[model samples]
Target: MRIGILGAGRMADALGTQWARAGHELMVSGRAPEKAAALAERIGPAARVGTFREAATFGDAVLLAIRDDGVQDVLAAAGAADGTLQGRVLVDCTNPVVPEKLTLKTAGGPSMAERVAAATRAHVVKAFNLCHEDVWRMTPPVFDGVKLAVPLCGDDPDALALVRTLVTGLGCEPIDGGALERAALLEATAAFMIGLWFSGANAQAVIPPLKYAFGAH
Candidate 1:
């Protein structure tokens, strides 16, 4: 898949590294073309850097990776909210974190994904905004892999499926988190996750999942 990831920040770079490792071609773009280029080089030959407009047009499925406050601007820049996103599966990996507290600020609660979907009327899927990028990128004590679970929410069937497949490609299990509004729970969970960062070893995590699958041991 030729993925257009909009942003050159940590999350964008993380996605680029994993996608490139998964043998997918990527167009990495952001406000800084030079930073995007450096990110592309670091990710390897399968990924290339370009301008935001180019990335938006070049991607088969676009990953909107940016700060919550920045989402509106980035989407506007990409002309996404103007229906430029139709027929494309948009993976919106944004947690509505307020700049001040670094916690979610969207209240009266429809979730960030829902708001985004309502704005664009695009097939938007909520994914990958939880969890810390650096920890996930750590040098693991390896096995085949420690498959991390990532929950996704969206109403669009095709869009969800596409995102699920991409999640698999990124070495994570994509749990169907039901409709897009469910993202409210997921986003609110962002705060508990932030608290965890201070509690001990778990705080630096993303939408920390509470569910567990146990087997007879």
Candidate 2:
């Protein structure tokens, strides 16, 4: 799979590293190409760095990993939700955590994923928001031993499948998180999770470390 990521921050590095190790081709882009290059080099030989336009053009799927406030800007700059992003599955990992408010920027109305979907018309899926960088960095290597559950949401079946495959490649179980509209819940949960980390618990400690639960069928 060819994955194009808009942000070259910790989230991209964490997941991109595992994707590359899993033999998926990756191209990372940011406001600066250098930052993308540096991260890509660390990922593996298959990963490359490019401009936002090029990244969008090169990838079969797009992962938006920019900051909460910067989501709109990066999407506009990267041509997401526009002519370029047509028919692409956009896996949004944004949390919308306002620095001043310390909560979500989209509190009153629809969620961030809704805004992006309305703007782009592409398939939007909420995923990877609940995870911390350390979780992906330290855990994916020992998948069978750890079996982490990763949740994702989108309207498109195919897009959801792709995200599931990507999550599995990262050594995590992909729980279907319902529709794109339900993305607000995920973002809010992420915000609460961040606050929990500040409550003296280790980041991964909050993540349960379970793959999936069995039912009493």
Candidate 3:
């Protein structure tokens, strides 16, 4: 698959490297040309650098990996509001949280994913926002013999399917996280988990095993 990545930051580097290794073609773009070039180089021949607009239109699916605050400006520069991203599969990995406070910027409104969808008019999928960059950099992201599970939320079936394939390519399991309307929950969950992690708490311990979720009866 041809994938376009809209940032050259850690998330871009980690996920792009993994995807490139999975034999996907990549076009990486960012506000910093040098960073984009360096990331593309790190990913080898399967990757190349481009401008924001070029990356937006270069792939079967585009990964919006930029910072939450810069999303609107970047999308506008990529012609998203002008229909350049229309009908495309847009995977949103951004989390709208104010890291210092570990609170959501959305403030009980639409999620970052929904905002992106409104801007791009694309088939948007909310995913890859739950973990840190290092987790994605892991070869398979397994823990105690259990593969990491990536939850995805999207309204479009085809778009979700494509994202699920990408998740599988990372040697992780894909979990259906319901429709796009439910993405706010995921974003909130991210904020909560991040806060827990920052406080040196094991967020995973808060959730019981699947078999115990509804009682062992």
Candidate 4:
């Protein structure tokens, strides 16, 4: 698969390296041309650097790994290529959570993914927003002998499947998170988890086991 990543940051580097090792062609782009080139060099020969517009136009699927506030700018740069992102499967990995309080910046309006979907004709899927980028760097981020389950919210089945393949390539499982409208819930989950994590709380302990929660245990 040809994968284009919109940022040269940690999220882009971690995921791009994994996908590149899995034999996928990678195109990395960022606001800084040197950084993008450096990332591509580190990812090896199969990976290359390009402008935001070139990256956006170069792949079968595109990962928008830019910061929450930078998504619109990247999209604008990409859309300038052909005037639209129609027929593209866009993966959104941004979180609108504030740094200190870990509260959602988009508490009253559209979630980050929804805003991206609304801004373009691309089929947007929300995913990978609930964990730190370093978590993605793990060879297989399993804990307690369970592969991490990544929730994906999208309306397009094809786009979902494509992203699921990418998720599995990182040795993670992709769990259906229902329709696109549910993306806000995932963003909220990120904010909640981040708050708990930063507060030195065991966020996982807050959730009962599935069987117990279902009253079947």
By lDDT, the best candidate is 3
**Among these predicted structures, which one has the highest TM-score?**
3
**What local distance difference test score does each model get?**
0.77, 0.82, 0.95, 0.90
Q: On a 0 to 1 TM-score scale, where does candidate 1 land against the true structure?
A: 0.84
lDDT: the better of candidates 1 and 4: 4
For candidate 3, write residues 141-216 as lDDT tens digits. Answer: 9999999999999999999999999999999999999999899999999999999999999888999999999978
Better of 2 and 3 by lDDT: 3
lDDT of 3: 0.95
| lDDT of candidate 2 over 127-212, digit per residue (tens) | 98886777888645454475777788789999999889988887778998898888998888888777766677665654443343
Q: Residues 17-61, candidate 4, lDDT per residue (tens digit)? A: 999988999999999999999999999998999998888888789
User: What lDDT is obtained when candidate 4 is compared to the true structure?
Assistant: 0.90
Deviating ranges (above 4 Å) for candidate 4: 80-82
List TM-score per model, in order. 0.84, 0.87, 0.98, 0.96
Best of the two (1, 4) by TM-score: 4
What's the ranking of the predictions by TM-score, best on top? 3, 4, 2, 1
How far off is residue 69 in model 2, in Å? Answer: 1.4
Least accurate stretch of 10 residues (summed lDDT) in model 3?
76-85
